[model samples]
Target: MTLDLQQRANRRMRRAVITLGVLVLVLVAALVVIALRGGDAPPKGAPAPQPSTTAPKPTATLPPDDGGYVAPAETVKLPDGATKSGDLPVKFPRTPDGAAAMAVASARNAWSLDPQRIRAGILAYASAQYRDQMAASADAGAKGNREFAGIPATGPVPAGATLNAWPIGVKYAAVDSDTVDVLVLLRVTHAAKTGTQPTTTLIVSPGRAVWEGGDWKGTATDPNQPLPDPVDIGTVGFNEDRWQAIQEGDRL
Candidate 1:
């Protein structure tokens, strides 16, 4: 009976050892598969990896920083045969192309309050260079007084006076180029109880001028329309209202 029991025990031990060996082999195979999938498997003949979501982005190109957004206007070069005068080359629309350029020019001109007509008048007449003389004359003219106290026509207008009317009765007049006009109007433009300072002036005066060429030469400019020469500023011209206002109290 003892011999039989020992044999049975030995058989059982052998079976148990074999089962443990089989389980160990299975575990080793599973670990190998996991390692291969992690990084060691033969890349499956796949393409190289693309950038992932967490990868850094490429740098973007940006425009150069300048004081102004507009690229500096480039000077145009003219063709050899396009010379206008001396070494200067003339290159531009030989002919006006329909209304595009004209339309743009007109729009820009209209945006300005002053017109070329009034500008022409200033060039042909008022000497802005002589500010003091004009101011003194203006004072005398408005007060119906004269700076050359002896000469009733040459006096300074009193301090506190305004010229508040359109010197020229007509709103619009056709003036040819290169002419000067002296306008006379009655306006009260200051804070005086005397009828001299009307709430608003009702002035009717004359503009003396000659039409020469296509330019109206002598109009006047106020703080708004002032200029070295009116013709130089706007191609269209100065507005009559502002010019007249500048020479306010001085109108006869």
Candidate 2:
């Protein structure tokens, strides 16, 4: 009877161990199926968006320049052979009488000029804005300056040194840009010796210009001369020769 009881206890223990092993095997199989299903499924179309790589920016532009004063149409070779541009130059009318009268009028309008000072230098200097032209006229006075600031002397004009008269020699010439030329015979005066009155001589050159305000004017500078000053928009037509042309006493 004791031997039978021991055999029955051993059988019961073996059955419990087998049940535990089967439960553990079922749990492991279920976990493996779940993992295989997840791995085998097709991937979704939408993915997390990534950051973008940016490109470089473009360059900036500069502003346009408005010429207040009449300037050269483009760059020009200077007397020194160097080139420069962007400046306001005086414009001259292309007529003999206009050229002759310009200097006289400028002299007459020279503010507070010593009425008796004769305006020798003023008359010559104010003819046009060209340093070259003015220097050319130095011989019209008492000075021996062959040149002023490196400009050679150009002598003998169409008119006299003193343009104190009217209906002087006049001629017209044409240039680019509807520009007309005026060649005027100026009458310049020199101090007389031996109690003689101022002597006179003729000066003729083309007065450069456009037909504005009932007259043609000259470019303050020679054609293509480099400008030391910048073009001013506020004074587009306000040039030295233009100013001299329309002065109070200059209504020709």
Best by lDDT: 2
Kindly list the per-residue Cα lDDT of model 1 for residues 1-252, writing each as its tens digit.
133443343333223221110000111111211222233333221111110001111011111234333221211121121223222122213222111111111111111112232122122222233223322332222122111111122233344433221222112223333222222222212233233423322222222222223211112212111112111011122232322222213331
TM-scores for candidates 1 onward, in order: 0.21, 0.25
Q: Which residue runs of candidate 2 sit more than 4 Å off their true CA positions?
A: 1-167, 176-178, 192-194, 211-216, 220-252
Per residue, candidate 2 scores C-alpha lDDT tens digits across 1-252 of 133443343233223221110000111111211221222342211111100011001001111345433542222111110111112112334343343244333322221112212233232223233324333322332121111101122433213222231212333445554454433322323332234344332222223444443333333323221112111212442243222222123222
Candidate no. 2 TM-score:
0.25
Worst 10 residues of 2 by lDDT: 50-59
Model 1, 54: alpha-carbon shift in Å? 88
